[model samples]
Target: MIKSRAVIARGKGEPVEVVRIDLPEPGPGEVLVRVQACGVCHTDLHYREGGINDEFPFLLGHEAAGVVEAVGPGVPDVSENDFVVLNWRAVCGQCRACSRGKPWYCFDTNNADQPMRLEDGTELSPALGIGAFSERTLVHAGQCTRVDPAARPVVVSLLGCGVMAGIGAAINTGGVTRGDSVAVIGCGGVGNGSIAGAALAGAEKVIAVDRDPKKLAWAEEFGATHTVNAAETDAVAAIRSLTGGNGADVVIDAVGRPETFEQAFYARDLAGTAVLVGVPTPEMEIKLPLLDVFGRGGAVKSSWYGDCLPSRDFPMLTNLHQQGRLPLDKFVTEEITLDEVEDAFAKMQRGEVLRSVVVF
Candidate 1:
């Protein structure tokens, strides 16, 4: 057993505590990782709010970059000392989705299958099955994707979740390409990533819509060609105006609110793609006019983990980061020790930072 300091979330709507936890040696096909850095995400906050599930005592923080410390039997692709990014979807190759060659949609992705517990032996449920808000974590071997060792862990770690989701929503899910005009609503990390992805894909124009001035300024750094303060104007109208009155070729709703969804619905050109990368609560229901749905001949899709295949994306994006193509370092607003996670949550709640990462 290994005793490691970790952030422990007791139950719904409770603050996390810094405490020592016990992690067992990896079982077969599992690898233990010494986390270098982990990002604080809204999903982690959601887990704390009981919005995810009933599982309590959640070990939050999933988006992380780490080094493999130990390997269990039968793990072939990785070894000790490998620098890797942890992914939640450890795709099971024989699943129906994988059988059809779409490994991204694998239905039976697995975790370590062994429980991490507190010092006294109470089980700790990992957030998104990774739980890297600690000195060490054990995960399925498939969850660890090796990347270039020279890259900074803080920058590359963002690709483990939010940044990847945002960028992939435009490139992978929405299929943004050269000359396409894209409009992104809600300029958070995901939204900005979408804008940058659109730019990287050679989009002719990328419009960022958000209520926060600071976020709008940050959007420009992420390759947004134009900005709209949604609070001061009609977001849909602004997008249409920026797109020469025809509307953008793709409209993305990254806020996940009903109002933002409605704005996305009308902000796209005819037959343009509408991608929803933001998560919403079950209590939120969107009402769209049936006529508009029929009139809009485009696809409205939702991105799960950016419809990503981590093995395919992690390496490529890391290479992009190394090549000075994707500005990953900008996403990290600040870094704090694991014990400061609670305060970081408060800053996130106040919209003061893009990402407050925990560096172990």
Candidate 2:
């Protein structure tokens, strides 16, 4: 066992506390990772607010990149000192989703069998099965996707969750292609990532929509060709105007609110796809016109983790970052220490930064 400083949310609506915890040795099929950088994501805040579940004394933070410290029994293709990005989707090949060859939708994901506990011996619930807001964390070996060691940990760590979801939402889920006009609603981290992904996919026009001017500017930095202040104008109409009054070929709703969802639904051309990568609260509901849904004649889908296959996408993205094809570095607005996670969460709530990374 080893002692590590970690951020923990003791209960719903409580502030996150940085406390020392005990990490156990990795068991079979597990690997112990010394977290080098972990992104303070909105999901961690959600966990704190009881938006995800009632699980508490929850160890927050998931978006992370780290170095393998040790590999447990039967783990293959990974070793100590390997730089890796942690993923929540560790496919169980025997599951129905994987058995059918769609590992991205793996119903049974793998996680560490052993638990990291609090000093008082309470087993902490790791956020998104990761809980990377620590000096070290134990995870299923498969969760650790090896990437180029040269990749900046602060930048690449965002790919572990939000950035990957945005990219995958465009390329994998929305099927964006060259010459396609894409509009992404909500120019936060995920939305900007979608913008970047659309650019990477060779979209002819990438429109960004958001209430915040700062976020829209950041969106531009991530390759947005146009910006719409949703608070100032009708986003759907603006998107249509930008796309010759026919709307975009693809519209991504990165803000999972009902109003933004409606905007995304209407901001696509007749045959264009609308991808919902935003996570909606359980009680929030969408009421769409049934006739419109039928008449729109396009796909309406939700993207889970951008429908990504981590092992395949992570390395590819890392390579793209290395080759300068993908500008992943622009996502990290700030780098902070683990103890500053609570402050980072405040910054996130205030929309002060795209991503505040906890760097070890």
Highest-scoring model, lDDT: 2
Superposed Cα deviation of residue 325, candidate 2 (Å) = 1.3
Q: Which parts of model 2 are misplaced by more than 4 Å?
A: none
TM-score of each: 0.99, 0.99
Q: What C-alpha lDDT, on a 0 to 100 scale, does residue 248 get in candidate 2? A: 93
What's model 1's overall lDDT? 0.92
Rate residue 53 of model 2 by lDDT. 90
Q: Looking at model 1, how many pairs of residues clash?
A: 0
| Residues 14-58 of candidate 1: C-alpha lDDT, one tens digit per residue | 889999999999989999999999999989999989999988999
Model 2 residue 183 lDDT score = 96
- Candidate 1: where is the Cα deviation over 4 Å? none
Minimum summed lDDT over a 10-residue window in model 2 is located at: 338-347
Model 2, range 194-242, lDDT digits (tens) per residue?
9999999999999999999999999999899999998899999999999
RMSD of candidate 2 to true structure, Å: 0.8
